[model samples]
Target chain A: MKIGFIGTGKMGYPMAQNLLASGKELFIYNRTKEKADPLAAFGAKILGCPKEVAASSDVVITMLANDEALLEITAGSEGLIHGLHEEGIHLSMSTVSPKVIQEIQSMHAAKNQILVSAPVFGRPDAAARKELWIITAGPLEAVRKCHPIFQALGRGYSNFGEEPARANIVKILGNFLIMTVIEALSESFSLAQRAKILPQDFLSAINQALFRSPLYENYGQLIVKKAFSEPGFTLQLGFKDATMARDLVESYRVPMPYLDVVYWRFLSALNHGKAELDFAAISSEVFDSWEDHPPLK
Target chain B: MKIGFIGTGKMGYPMAQNLLASGKELFIYNRTKEKADPLAAFGAKILGCPKEVAASSDVVITMLANDEALLEITAGSEGLIHGLHEEGIHLSMSTVSPKVIQEIQSMHAAKNQILVSAPVFGRPDAAARKELWIITAGPLEAVRKCHPIFQALGRGYSNFGEEPARANIVKILGNFLIMTVIEALSESFSLAQRAKILPQDFLSAINQALFRSPLYENYGQLIVKKAFSEPGFTLQLGFKDATMARDLVESYRVPMPYLDVVYWRFLSALNHGKAELDFAAISSEVFDSWEDHPPLK
Candidate 1:
């Protein structure tokens, strides 16, 4: 099967490489052509636009940044919708809003094509290791055709049935859950520091006792050492994902108060010019917020 | 060493059983005398009051319900502070506020009796199996002397140094973190249900992909099944812990917005007559709040 890949950025670059390693006939495109050029060494054909890539391949996988970038490449004049053949599959792997994905799915349906939402969980390092967890939903036939592709890109995949938006909602909620952990850790660690407790010691005790989750341990260590200069997922992306969650809950008129708190923390992190730092850097906002407290003996 | 075990509730009973199993000379007490009667068959001496239990043993372990009960047993006329010998150690295992523990610590300190905060994590079953995680902070000599007792009650223990309140603060923060997960799961599951996604499927995917923590799996299962009748931890106790977290954050003047959200959820759960239900039943509040939303097709 021929697979066209778009948006060869940090996460996408490694994912696209794994596709080539799996011996699939691959075509690629990127907003910056140089990022796609590296794939040529692995026998991938670099195309000029999303439309051209879609026209040449049986399946096109998009791993874009956010909803805007995803929609631009899917519905733009030089978009995948303009050139993909009938029954072709557009597999979206971006962390995007469910509403937009539903809209895009209907547009694809109108053209006799399929849009499979398969957003993934894992950072770039996990992507490089092909250890990403993919959540997929779409027509069963289309999803079945993409099984080998999913195998090449992820450690495992869970299908949320045939509604494409289900996968996106699950992805958004998963990110929302992760952000909540970051915020919880930040607030508690801030209080711990004020109480003359070492942040590392507090994290050690809680992680060992309650969570036993790498998600908690990784974020806890990042917050403890104040390591924000390097980012697995940036504050900008975190803010985008948080906004997606906010949009989702608002659309359904369901109240998710925890999301509101995390959303504001991400916004505060962005306004303080830490957008390039790791999303876990939001702990800095939490720590800074408690500056007025007198240090304990 | 001779040990006194007070409270004899669900958690205290199993813990006291383990202490007796480890062959320490045990004295047991309970507000309702009948509750301590069963332990007498296991080589435990059923005592009349907290004072009698404390006076008979070298170490007294208190595992009461909340701050009020703990304070009543520690500082009241028939309290451990009055009956314990000059060098006796008071090991507190209840989930109470750091402020109350500090107050009790000072009272014990005046009489040269050591107060060690050693709050534990695990349900009644974990306590019964001697699999609880213990967090301890007190004077070095006192903590070391109680090492065998901690081993009898827990799988492992982490020491937080000489300040007894430090361990209490860590325990509060740990519980606060767990409550945040419950709130996050509740809100997301509510959204997933409204979107026609099965809560079990949503939980299975996220737990396998993101958390991989038993804490998430257990609570997720409880919220999914709406199984609150047999609570591992009651909603009333959950509310008390949430209140303690609120009090801690307020006293330190630190902003913990996430705690504010969980605090209100616990309050709503209690207000709706869910005090006897499992703490995970707070999800019911999330579901009920969204009742006005028209059912999805």
Candidate 2:
């Protein structure tokens, strides 16, 4: 069965290329058509929009940026929901609000089209390596049908029950966990630096002792070096996920005491002109300018 | 060189046992001597007090509970400092305040005795396994002299510098980071549980995805299971460390915005009668009572 891929942004571009390299029969579409052009040389058929891509393929995979992008591509006047064949599957591989996933699932259900939420964990680089962790939920049959596509795009996929939106909630919750870790590291680095202990030293101590994770090693170094210019994940998008998590918790009537702190740290990072930087830039929001303090150690 | 091991608490008991098992001549002391009796089988000699332990050994290791214990053991009438030999070294293996460490260092310096702050990271079980991470700071010569002792007691050690108190600061900061993580996990778990996502599910997703630290895995499981009865580190000691961090940041004029939040979480947990519970019990502070909500997916 032919597969159509949508949204060739940082994460999607590498992910889609990995599928192409795995020799999948592919069709592609993006709002900025040029982004999809690079994949065309690798035997991917480029399409004008989601509608054409859906009409041309058995399964259409979308890795759109956010809620509005996913909504527009799937439910807009000339969208995939209007053109997908009977029993055709739409595999959502983007991180979006669970509520939006539920709405989109209903839209697909009305026409007897299958929708599977298969959001992923990892940055763009991990996507390129096919090391991304894929999370899936929906009808078991549809998930099984899309197994080959998942294998090509990610290292593994975790199935979280039959509700497509459950995968979305897991993705949202996953990002919320990331932001919380970043905030914790930011606060810790600030405390370490202020105490005449190098931020890197404090990071090394804990990391060596117990926190032996790639998340700590990667973000801990970025935070210690104060290097936030490169945007693996922008602060703006990070803030969006935080807001979504806050909304999810509020709707459920659960209290997340530190989430507000995570949200505000991202908001404060944005306010300080860190929109284009990596979310690890939130460290700046938690710490002051280094020059203001005398040599501590 | 004869080694004196004081404060045979949960961590210290296992740690001292390991040292004695490694064939070191050990003189042990504790407020309640019964705690040290277990070490006698491994050729450890019981001493009357910190003063007697210091008098009988070339190097004294004090692994007390807090600043007050360290201060009382080193500066009180029957303290270690009074009995230490002219060139003897005091290897403090406790989590205490940097200010207190500095004061203790001064007391040792006045008596022509050397002091090295060599605080550790790990729970009681890790200490038993000799997997505890030891962090040190003081004169390089003293640190070098105590290298064999550090090797016997821990997996590895990181020396900060000649400033003895720097190690204490690192230990305090490490505990602060752990509390921050517990607070973050507590908040995130509440959001996930309320959102029909099980806390264990949220934990599995994050642990599998990014935050795959032992810190996240261990405490995440404990918080999810609501198993805070057994104290790896008590909520009271966690609060003391948080208070120490707050004081450190305040003294250094460094702003740790989320530290106050952590301090309050621990304070609130204490207020609700969780002083004896594990610090992961701070999760109880972030989550509402189980009766207030129905079972979530």
Candidate 3:
């Protein structure tokens, strides 16, 4: 089966390369065409646009940045909807909103095609290692047909059922959970610094004795050292995820009161011109906002 | 060394047993007295009051419930302070306020005695296994002298310098961080359930991928199952810790905006009569308070 891939940014580039390595005939596209040039070395064809990629492949996957990019590539003029043939499937691996996926699913349904929501859980590093978690949902037949494709891109897959937006919802909530953890680490590190305990000592103790997790170890070290200059995931994108989570929570009518704090911190980080820094930069914001250091009130 | 053990409750009982088994001459006291009875077989002498235990022993350890209990046992007219010798040191393992610990320290100083704050991190199960993390702070010589006692009672110890209240601050902040995590997990689980995904599935994926820690694994399962009963640590005590954290934050003049959310949720849990349940029961509160479930706004 032929596979077309779109949006070859940091995450998508490595993911598409893995798909090509798995012996799939791959057609790739990126807004900045140069981003897809590296994958051409392995005999993958670089297409010009999403529409062009869609026309030549039975299964087309889009791994764009946000809801806007996903929408433009899937539903805009010169988009995938104009080119995908009947019985074709458009698999989305972008972390976008459920609403966008729902809209795209309707657009695909109109053309007698399938749209599968299969947003993944992993950083670009995990993507390079082919260690992502493919959270998938759509028609059962479509998911089953794409199982081999999922295997090529990720370590494993969890099917969230037939409704395409279910996968998007899960992905959004998962990202929200991650931001909440980062905020927790930020606040604790801030408090540790204020209390005259080194953030390193506090993080070391908790990581060893209680929170023995990669999330803590990785983010804890980054936060303790205030190493946010290089972006693993930028603060701006982290803020976008936080905003989307707030929207989802509001739509669900759930009182996620703590999320308000996460949203505020992310926005503050961006406001302080930390848009290019790692999301863990929120720790510095947290530490700075403490009213006074030692002799508090 | 003659050791005085006060408050033989869930944590104190096992800790006292470990000390007794380590061949220390132990004098144990509990308000109800019966709770200390089990230690008698191991040659422990069950005394009538905190005063009696303190009068008979050189180094005393108190592991009561809260600030009030700690205050009464340490400073009330019939308390340990009135009974101890001039050079005696009181080691407090209960989770209480930095303010309360400082007050108790000053009271001990007035009597030419010493108080060492050495709160622990572990559940009753870990306490039984002697794997608790003992966090200590006091005079350097005093903490050094109690090294063997802490070793017998815990897997390891971290000394936070000579300020007796420093250990209390760290314990309070550590508990606050744990509550923040529980609240984050609850919010995510509530959202996952709303999205028609199983909390177990969401938890399992995150645990395997990012949060590879016992804190997430243990508490995530309990919250997912709504198995908050049988009290690993009760909602009531959790609320107390959150309240103390707020106090500490206010005293330190630092703003922990997220903790306001945690404080409110813990109070809500207690108000909903989950006072006797495990702290993970906050997940239930989070689920119940959702304005509507499937048909959100």
Report the number of the highest-TM-score candidate: 2
DockQ of 3: 0.56
Say what the interface RMSD of candidate 1 is.
2.7
| CAPRI accuracy category, model 3 | medium
What TM-score would every model get versus the actual structure? 0.95, 0.96, 0.91
On TM-score, who's better, 2 or 3?
2
**Candidate 3, A50-159: lDDT as tens digits:** 89899999999999889999989988888988889998999999988899898888889999999999999888888999988888899999999999998988888888
Error of 1 at B25 (Å): 2.5
Ranked by TM-score, the better of candidates 1 and 2 is 2
- Give per-residue lDDT, candidate 2, residue A57: 92
lDDT of 3 by residue, B3-103 (tens): 99998998999999899878999998899877789899999999888898899988999999998999999988789999999989999999998899989
TM accuracy, model 2: 0.96
Worst 10 residues of 1 chain B by lDDT: B288-297
Model 1, stretches more than 4 Å misplaced?
A: A292-297, B292-297
Quantify all predictions' global Cα lDDT against the true fold. Answer: 0.91, 0.85, 0.86
* Number of the candidate with higher DockQ, 2 or 3: 3
